[model samples]
Target: MSSQARRRSRGTLYLALCGLVLACLGFGAALWAQDHTTWFKRLRGGNAWSLTYQGDAVGGQGSALTIRYRFNPDSFKPAHRIEQLGRTHLPWSVHALVNTGEVARVEVEPEGHTVATCRILLDDVRVVAEGKSPAPGRPAVCDVTTSSTPEKWPR
Candidate 1:
């Protein structure tokens, strides 16, 4: 064809390559997309954050699950502090799932607040969780289960 036509085609190809690169980046983001208050998003406590998560929130027909974990500020280099968790932490209100469908009743409570007192009802379901700040001079600690298992992460 003509030189002008060839040049135009070349320019179109460059633009197409750029578009493809951006599309790939977008797809990558979607794969990594996470809810703002997702337990694993704003992880803190440094590497000491032993994240024990499971897909038990939803039954057999569910696509998402609620995760619970704990962190001790002494788990890593103290300088990093809570930076590892980004800006995420417990929220007064959040979302989780249940056996049947969406459990939009997830509740975040300030550590030390009444665990049972904080509950939200949406339509006909309720989601709940609680937080407990470490006792003074004890650093931050979390108990994910009822068993007598207390873990301490030393820096």
Candidate 2:
């Protein structure tokens, strides 16, 4: 090949290689940005929360009661407090108060009962029952810690 032609071809190949490297770097940076953005959104409470609780009823045939609370992303406060939305099938009324993604307090009142009130605490996977009318064989104020997350609770 002529000297000038050979030099030109080499220059073209170099430019193509450089372009490919830059494109790969750009793609890597974009992927990193996307991953970090998703993490930030979760930390800022941009993701919805689904808290579930399962335990035996206070009385009457020893049936188990399952309570599920769904909190929209907007309803989650920086302090980890979630406001009750509406229209839930929770057997008893619940006051959603979550703290630090670990501790949660829920006030419950059985149906057709006005005097008895109960409080449930979710300490990570552990569930503590308190107040009047607790489950049989379980103390009025007791902690029943489990090794499961709220999402993994039985439906």
Candidate 3:
């Protein structure tokens, strides 16, 4: 082959190799961003998380109760507090994000046979954890600490 033709072919091959390398790097970066950022999770679909409280006493006669729980990205902060649960509010449920190293807690005040059961669900299907407290006239506290991120959730 002519020297000019050989040089041109070599340059083309080098450019192609560079392009391939850049494509691989872009793919890897996309994966890393997906794992590390919430924007990517929103693009695909935010992780589905559900916290539920239920128990025998939930349906039975009981006085107004206090409920506390934590299901946010910030694990250092204290659990959110609410006082709307009562005899009529049995089987309370709410949806929120619960990342790894965080907790799903349900604390019901010791009110007239109050029993509290807590459940944490990921993707609306996977049961991450659950707990129950059934002692009457005693604080019914249920806690579940998650250890791992969901398969599709951002780390």
Counted clashes in each candidate structure: 4, 1, 0
List clashing residue pairs in candidate 2: 126-145
lDDT of each: 0.31, 0.42, 0.57
Tens-digit lDDT track for model 3 on 5-117? 99999999999999999999999998988777765544454343444444325555454366565556433343443334554454555666555545566665546666655
Query: What's the lDDT for candidate 2?
Result: 0.42
Scanning candidate 2 in windows of ten residues, the lowest lDDT window is: 139-148
True-structure RMSD for candidate 1: 17.2
Lowest-sum lDDT 10-residue window in model 3 = 74-83
- Candidate 3: segments with Cα more than 4 A from true spot: 31-50, 56-79, 82-84, 96-102, 109-116, 134-139, 146-155
Give a tens-digit lDDT track for model 2, residues 1-155: 99999999999999999999999999999999976875665556533333343223443323213223332233345344334333223334433333233444343323333223344544333335555544333322222222223233332
Q: Which candidate has the top score in lDDT? A: 3
Rank by TM-score (best first): 3, 2, 1
C-alpha TM-score for every candidate = 0.29, 0.40, 0.50
lDDT ranking from best to worst?
Answer: 3, 2, 1
